[model samples]
Target: MLTQLNHIRARRADLRRDIDVVHSFEAWEESCVPSYCHPNWLAAYVSWIRLFRAAELARTIVPAPARILDFGSSVGELGHLVSEGGAGYDFVESDQHSADYLVSRLPGARRVTLEDAPEGGYDQLFAIDSLEHNENYAELLEVLAGKLAPGGVLILSGPTENRLYRLGRRIAGFDGHYHETTIYAIEAVAERLLARRAVRQVLPVAPLFRISAWARKS
Candidate 1:
């Protein structure tokens, strides 16, 4: 895990050098990429570790070499872990710039549209820190769950939105206007469509994020 984290840090540095950090479109601000590559050690550590935790949680259920889809994958940071495990990686990124960057980083990974994501095509589906941004995350979760093959797992992680989480976001300089709901709300809806397998609290001491795994109900 340490080795993987180092590799991610290096790649994040490369991304910072390659991409525009202060763009007018707010894309940079919208992306967690900046946070991952933040010069401030604490900010960067928090952002990168969250993805690490999410991917680590995923590996517990969806072992390597499985067909995987990273929904709303931002520039495909998780693709590093997916590729390392020899999994067939696919991603859906609505932001064209991020999508192009993701392709550049993980050329082997397929880029699929949300509507075109093959149903029952993936053995594992991930929606880390992405679903809560959408008001229709419940409907989106249902559709994403459908893309999973029988016995497949859907791994998720998002802000807890508790006071602690809100405080952290403010400290990090984000108002979190993009988030339509909280991870708690998302999980509540997920329980209706999938059976919960496991749950972990990120930064268990402070408990800012929730990482969960679920499978389609039998």
Candidate 2:
């Protein structure tokens, strides 16, 4: 069942998603950053390839599902990969331009209605590089915690601002980009947050400096 709105927003207000910072590809399209980021997401592909590793970790834990919700998904990059893995997924994006490109892939992606997400209990939920966009990151996590099915898993990947990825860029010489809540230390910090939130597990399996945790509701 979906959580109530005002209460949910109020709960979301308590969390702070400060920077810990920091994905792959179909054809490089300005509208679809996720697909454009695909090739760069996997290991040994992009120059700074930890992003790809993040996707890998998520793929490893998220089992095949009848229904999947790819939150903040851009142009279905990882969504398509998961689909190929034998799971059906629904890509959710707030931006219509990007969502339009994603729909080209599925030919059925509906526009995200902010009041509530696509209905039904999904087996999997993913929010990559997305939490910071919320008030900080807490509100987003609260919503995510409420979204999962009893045993479903939610995968979140992001940088803790300026700290995690920028230092990595020094050695790699990649240009620094902007991210709201980037963290250089995710393993310890994220593990703590996940535990308090009542998430069943916190697995940091990635080449990326941030985090990719699998939270299951029991």
Candidate 3:
């Protein structure tokens, strides 16, 4: 186990050093994929799924048309799952490089554009850690509110500042600046985005330091 972990750590070491944003499809395909480094597939998978825990939780809520969105979908993990039913999967990604990667993974899903996202709109909305990648966290829910069909479901997942996160970062030697925010500390941050009468559900992905929240229109 230790040996395997070491291998993953080495790969992550390379991925951690730079933040030169990937700018285009060509660069993403030719350069990004080659440079894409992940140390542990299991940990990576957990992180990928953590981003969209909201989508899964949304399943418990009822909606119409079931239109879905994978916000900030890197390499398309959520897209791949959505494509299983060939449902309407809208992958909204700002990074052209990662978006391109998502396109390849989700050939059937449509590219969800910000303009196309309607107000009070989608029947089913889900995104993983992708929401945090953007600057306007509050604006995100407002946009989704309009896009959802009435009585729709919204699922979103990300980290909650906790002891597990600290340990994970220490073990992986990766930065946790963005993920360490406590959900309780900023509890109202998301509450402010929601409708007054909606139903909500919450789940914790332990050790992963992940939280998924589900809200249903009233």
Q: What is the TM-score of each candidate against the true structure?
A: 0.93, 0.59, 0.66
Instruction: Give candidate 3's TM-score.
Output: 0.66
Q: Identify the candidate with maximal lDDT.
A: 1
lDDT of each: 0.82, 0.47, 0.52
Better of 1 and 2 by lDDT: 1
Error of 3 at 119 (Å): 2.4
Cα deviation at 157, candidate 2, in Å, is 0.4
Candidate 3 per-residue C-alpha lDDT over 123-211 given as tens digits, one digit per residue, 9 for 90 to 100: 66765544554456667656765566667656655555467766765664455444433443223555665543332223333644445
Off by over 4 Å in 1: 23-25, 84-87
Best by the TM-score measure: 1
Better of 1 and 3 by lDDT: 1
Weakest 10 consecutive residues, lDDT, candidate 1?
20-29
Comparing 1 and 2 on TM-score, the stronger one: 1
- If the candidates were sorted by their TM-score against the true structure, best first, what order would they fall in? 1, 3, 2
lDDT string for model 2 (1-218, tens) is: 13323322332232112111121122223222422222233321232233344445555665556667777775555554455532466666766655765666566544454246643366667776665545446655655556666556666666543444456545443443334454333223445444322221112342344445555423
Taking the tens digit of each residue's C-alpha lDDT, what string does model 1 give over 1-218? 68966886688778877886656336677777767766678777777777777777777887764688999898888788766432489898888888888887777888888799899888778898999999899999889888988878889899888898788778876788999999989999899988999998867787888899998888
